[model samples]
Target chain A: MTASIRQMGVITAHLIRKVAFNPAVVWLIAMPLVIIYILGITMHGLFSAEFTPVKPYRIVVALPEEAGFLVERISRAPKHFAVEEARDAQEARQAVFQRQADAAIVAADGDEPLTVIAPPGSIVLEMLAGVVQASLEQEAQQVAAAQPPVENGSREESDTGARSAGAADGALSAMPWEGVGSFEYFSIGLIVMFMAFASHSAMVHCVQDRSTGAYLRIRALGVTRAVYLGAGITSGMLLGAGFSLVMAVITWTLFRVVWGNAAAWALMTIAGAASVASLSFLLTALLPSDPKGVENAGGTVYSLLAFFGGSTVPLTIMPRWFSEIFSWLPNRKMLDGYLKIVKGAGVKEIEQELFGLAAAALIMLGLAWLVVMLLKREEV
Target chain B: MATHAAVQEARGQAAGDPSIVVEGLRKSFGKNVAVDGLSFTVHPGEIFGLLGPNGAGKSTTLSIMAGLIRPDSGDVKIGGHSVIRETQRAQRLMGVVPQGLAVYEELTAAQNLDYFAKLRGIEKKRRRQEIEEILELVGLSGVAHRKVAQYSGGMKRRLNVGIGLLGRPRVLLLDEPTVGIDPQSRRHILDSVRRLAESGMAVVYTTHYMEEVEYLCSRLAIIDRGRVIAHGPIDEVRALAGDAVVLRLPFPRGVLDEAAKVESLQNTLPMPVEVTSGELRIVLPQGSRQAPAVIEELQRHGVPLDGMRLESPNLETVFLSLTGKALRDGKAAEEGAMA
Candidate 1:
């Protein structure tokens, strides 16, 4: 076991030298930082405009003339309330449907519960509902103070308060890139992107090793095939992780983009490295004789991955299905993790992305193992 | 020609049990048979040559003996360890210098040797000294720290050989280590290999260049179509061709193939006709007076000829006399198939 580990370590170090000494490594580090800077400086203005504080909420209330007191109280409320009276329930519903208002509130007699009408995922919906709920509760308090309580509500008051809080939490989490600057998003996004491209560079090394017979020579030294493969994967991870570090440091220095939570970033970086490195290892194993597929199509493949994963463009700007598709891509998961890390999310908060990346890496690793086995069948 | 005294010295050194023993090795890739029932043995301190063309299964045989691949049947034993069952144990006893330039171009020559030394489990304190010794031995001590990518072809080839010698294994397997390099580099490599054998290390040198084997190896095995057709002491193998003179003519591929296929020219000559990719070899009995007639017939057939040369009986002629095909015919077929 000691010998095996020594062999793996030596070979891994050997491969690392092969990658780190290549003059191309300089370009690997510089190109991504250049892109991140250009993309960050040029596009920050456009994205910052979207993240600016939203306008006042417009709520249309449908209630009887006797209930003018509730509407009057809501209009004077804080939290940027902009309430408009409706002729009837139809007009109130029409206001929300026509997008003229953020939400609508309908009511009947005093004992009847209020109904909220708002579009799904509307950022103002939760706050507006909270305002209307607070008004009703205040009115009920006044009535309760005047007379004896006849019956309790169907659901517990605790439950209603909890649901209101939970709804606010749900809406906030559902929104992507809140409190995230365009510079930070592009910083992490481009880093994650270039991290994957580093695998291609690593693949070129593997191809050279194979073409030049270095791999065969090492195998002849009583080293196991697994050790050689492990070395390739280990070196690949190092190369990719190194790029992200240098690029991250450059962006932080130049663009003032802070990558938060060292432990979280480390895990994501490792996971991203594993995801891409294992994937590159898989291609090398799969194409024993011909790595042309990877050599020829690697740029296009990574670009597609970046485009679909919201690295090239934000998923929020794309269709909703893009976000759904992002969940399946390891790159997208890495981008997600980086975004969350920049937002000060701890390891626990980004564990989902980590799990996703880990699973993808493992699957690629498993597939690579199977390919190595198949290659072993040739006994060469 | 090997001196009788040198052969006697080699014979004395080979008195003990052989260091490498390959028996009945057979392997096939799908429908193509790479090695078929091949057997050979090399004693310690002997520079044994496995002479063959590019596709004569020399590399595959060496690969199997080195435990890099498994033979379909039979096995190779290195220092008494079975290559098939005890592969790692067998492999540790041998150092392999592959046909290609296997040293890492991105690494310095010293770094390449150091990497292999560490991988071979050499002690850290001893590794640095050993690397320097190897670099000196391969004639690369002056540029030990320079990256191999900047190295000349010969320098790279020497590093390739240097890496194999780091572990000081009992046996060395060199698969065409001097295929394409300058005469200076080839001389250096051959001298290094000869010195390795003289130091009591058993060596198996595989190559199609018969002259290298003649100059370096004491004993040789001539293989064709994955089988050894001739093997013994160099003198005995050379004697197989008798006193026949070999005539070689170089031509374009198209002309060579047409010359090989011309039935009238073949039937009229009454001698074996062999065509390689762009060369032809014909063995003739001295005083037969068939050379002028053969050329005239070829001219009559309008077959283009680049030039012609007369050669003495060596492994090239012996191989043609035995297999009735040029060494490179098999090589070309194999390359075409691979392509």
Candidate 2:
């Protein structure tokens, strides 16, 4: 017992020296930091843009009767526009085409038929067009009422309001990126990418040690299997946490993005790393003794998992069945949980996801332990 | 002079207990039996050599003693502690130098020693001193700060020896200690072992190198097929092949006519002379006076001797007599299988 404990201390010291001083060890640690730095820089702009206070859209109205209400709604609405009125439809079109106004509303026939126009693919224009069209349609229906105008009681106004509300909901739902910027989406994807690289590299080290007779040497020193594996997971955790933090800082400095609570984020970093370490150990153990076997099997497993886990595609956009399948992949659970934490989710909000990640980590670590125990029993 | 002084000190302290004893050890790996019903005892202050071919169970026996591998059936006692029952206690009394260079390549030699010394629970104050002493003892002081990866094979082997000596166990088990070392490093290692023995460390050295056994071991066991074929003093072991004087003489012309003269010469000389092929090999009853008379008889017959080799038996003949084949042939066969 004393021998084992003393050996553990020795092994720990070596681990520190390897991670702290050796170039290979430094590179193992530094590679993740570099990725984090790159991702933080790359994704910072997107997060800031997603959450930034949106500016009002400039508009021009070319309608005579219905245009009055359109201009009022454009000017007075909570998040609609900066209002302007063009003399005619031609002038309004010119305003939009010349980039002077983001959108224009023209009243065309009796009861004032409305034609809403904006620059193609312009987010501000798209929102403004929907807003102006709703106001104009309301005014047109108000004039069509046959009964006395009762205060807040016209059936046509209520009907148009309901339709407008439904249309507004549809428009918002159509563009997912409108609410979540491209940077946030990219940041989430980079987290998974970093994990993949870290896990793969960790497995490579395991294979090297096994084949090179180093494992046998260490075993002969009375270093138990548990100590050996615990050190491995510890190394992986250090790598993952160091990587995630660098990436987070870089993300903040470059994008001016704000992340969640520091404590929550710290737990996320540790959990994420533990999950990756488990995965790396599982994959390394699954690989046959042949060097080429790892390449072949690892390629298939990585590709399939990355595809399903939203590393390459957003899980939200994937088919319902595909998403359901992804729930089974530990990578998906971790990435989902990590993204939620990074996206400013509170502990209560991400509790279920965190539990799921923890469960997967434990299962994977348990499996790795079993496999390693079996392997140890075989030869050395 | 130092060796004499150390040996004198050892004699004063040498106690009644045997250092290591193995009885009826049996171990099998899958279908192959590694050590089968093997047994031996190593007394204090003796260099006991385990000599055999590659698969002759030498390594298995050493590993069992070192507590690295569990024996299927056996009783191994180190300083009166059962290896299986009191492994840590038994291991505390022993140090093992494995066949492979087990030193960490990423660490400096001193760092490697320091790490292992700490594992062995050497006092913090004494650890550095002991590491430096072992480094100097192994003649690796100048290069102690260099990472083991930069070391030549011989340097690594020497460091392997140094680590085994760090805890200063009562018994040191070295598996091919001089293997892969340069001639200088090899000599340095052998001398270190000699020093340890003189200082009263019972050493169990396993190797296929007979010259090493002859040079370093006072007693040896010739093992084959996982069994000890012979074990005793080196001279006693070699005596299994009777006393024979080997003469490297010129090929005699009249082989059949010389046979009659050699027989007549045998009656007059103190030893019996037999001519096989070209050389006259004489088996003495046990006297040195026969050589002069044999030389005179060969001269009388005009045997025209070009050269002569006269010596008592050695391990080579002993090994051949026991195995019915040379040790080298058996080692070649084992290497072939491994390759």
Candidate 3:
């Protein structure tokens, strides 16, 4: 057993050396970083705070007698809320149906104080409703404070009021700009995608070795099949980890994107590496001995996976149903885990995603083993 | 000198166990039988040659002996370990150098040797020394640090052999190790094989080049159509052509056109006369005794000879006699089938 381990170590070292000198590996490692950097610099204005939308949320106010006052109030935060005056409820509803406005508000002289009508399943409508609710609540609080204090208030009531006020303050304080910039988010995606490709290139090395007779030579040296395959996997993982480190350094130093929870990031990195390596192995094992065939097939499959996994485009811009489907992909989970780590998510919060990635890695590795076993039998 | 003596001593210690026993080996690829009921053995200090045309089951047999492939119905044992049942032990006692160059082109010669040494379970402390000795044995010590990609064909072939010699196994299988290289390198490789056998190692050398077998192999097996047609010591196998001597008489075209005249010459020549394109070949049972008479009769008939020569039998002639075709013809047929 020790001898096998030693042999695996030797093969792994040789594979690593081969990768280190390979020009293709160097290009694969540098490509994603260069592309992300260029995109970041050229599209800097798109992510700047000053380039806020002119009118993000359009709302029509139709309150009859109080329409002007409500419109003025809603329009105070013009960058976030765009208010348009309507002649009446009918006009307001017509405007929303025509898609001229995202939503409409109607003041009522009934028990419900206000009525909000918007398109079904619209995120913009949800945010508008939240904003309106918060505004109304603040107004009601001020009106209450202006009145005389009640002298017979119970001590339990006062403590409850104080706790509620503190909780509201905490929520407000936590509501700062916690979103990731487009450059940073896409950079992470590109890094994950490149790592997958780099792992595939490692499998390409395996194919080359086999074609060039190096594999036969080592096998004749008494190296077991398991040791040979184990060495390849180990080398791929090491190469992936190295690429991840370079990506992390470049992003941190250039874009100042900080990762959260070092332990979680490390775990995610390892899981991601295993997933990519095993997937590459499975794909390569399925291909025939022809190197060109393997390259073309692997390239096509990986490109399709990267596209559907949100590496080519952000899931946020994709249709909701499509993004949901993308969410099930391992590369998508890898990107999500890394993004969450960068957004200050703790280990426990991202544990399920990490588990998914780990499970995927294990399953792929198992499949890869079965494929290799079949191939070995055919070889014999 | 010290390294050579050390190798000698190591081989001497391993001499008692240096025997490769192949028993009833049979293998087939799908419907094509590559080897059929083949068996052979090599004792210590012997160079056993496997001479066959292309696709004649030489490589398949070698692969089975090296434990790289499992036979369909038989087994190979090296140093008392079955290749199929005791693979690791059997493999430890054997080394294989494939027909193709198997060294990594991106790595230096030293690095390639070092890597294989480690895989062969050589101790790290002695790896450097062993690598140096192997490089020396293959005459590649001077270019040890150069990348194999930059080396000449001979250099790479030498490195390939060096990698196979790292563990110093009792049995070594070389499959066409000198296929395409300079003559100097071929000579060096042949010399190395001779030295290895002299130092008490059993070597199985496979090649298509007949001269190599005639010069190096003490005993050989000639295989055709996945079966051994002839097997024995070199001279004994050559004697398969029998006592007939071959005489070549190149004549002018149309010199022996008359059937009656040819029959008359045949009756007087003391041998059978076979006429081919512009030449007359005579196979005599005792050429030295009847040579003068045969030449005088041919001259008397005015056969118009352009040139005349007498030859002895060799491996090529023996191969032709056994298979009824030359080795080149067999190779061409194999190529045509493959194409």
DockQ, in order, for the candidates?
A: 0.50, 0.14, 0.43
Give iRMSD, candidate 2. 3.4
Q: For model 1, which pairs clash? A: none
| Model 1: per-residue Cα lDDT over B1-339, one tens digit each | 244335435545435578888899999988989898988888777899998877899988987887778788998989889988998898888898988788877678987888888888899889988888889999999999998989988888888898989878889999888766778888999999998887778899998888789999989999987988998999999999887677788656553456445555667676777766656677775523667877787788776656887788888888877877666555543443332
Q: By summed lDDT, which 10 consecutive residues of candidate 3 chain A come out lowest?
A: A153-162
Q: Model 3, A166-276: lDDT tens per residue?
A: 122233233212256767776887888888776676677777777766777788778877788888888888888778888888778877878778999889888888888
Better of 1 and 3 by DockQ: 1
Predicted candidate 2 versus true structure: per-residue lDDT over B73-96, tens digit per residue: 888998889877886688777877
Q: Give stretches of model 2 more than 4 Å off.
A: A1-6, A25-222, A250-258, A280-308, A312-320, A378-380, B1-16, B241-339
TM-score of chain B of each: 0.87, 0.75, 0.77
* lDDT, residue B223, candidate 3: 86
lDDT score at residue B262, model 3, on the 0-100 scale:
70
Model 2 Cα RMSD, Å?
Answer: 13.3
Q: What is the TM-score ranking, best to worst? A: 1, 3, 2
| Structure candidate 3, residue pairs in collision | none
In candidate 3 the C-alpha lDDT for residue A187 amounts to 81
Q: Candidate 3 on B72-159: residue-level lDDT in tens?
A: 9878889779989998888888888888788889889998888888889889888989898998999888888988999988889888
**TM-scores of the models, in the order given:** 0.79, 0.66, 0.74
Fraction of reference contacts reproduced per prediction? 0.75, 0.16, 0.67
Q: Which ranges of candidate 1 are over 4 A from the true structure? A: A49-173, A291-293, B1-14, B250-270, B276-279, B285-296, B303-310, B329-339
Error of 2 at A152 (Å): 30
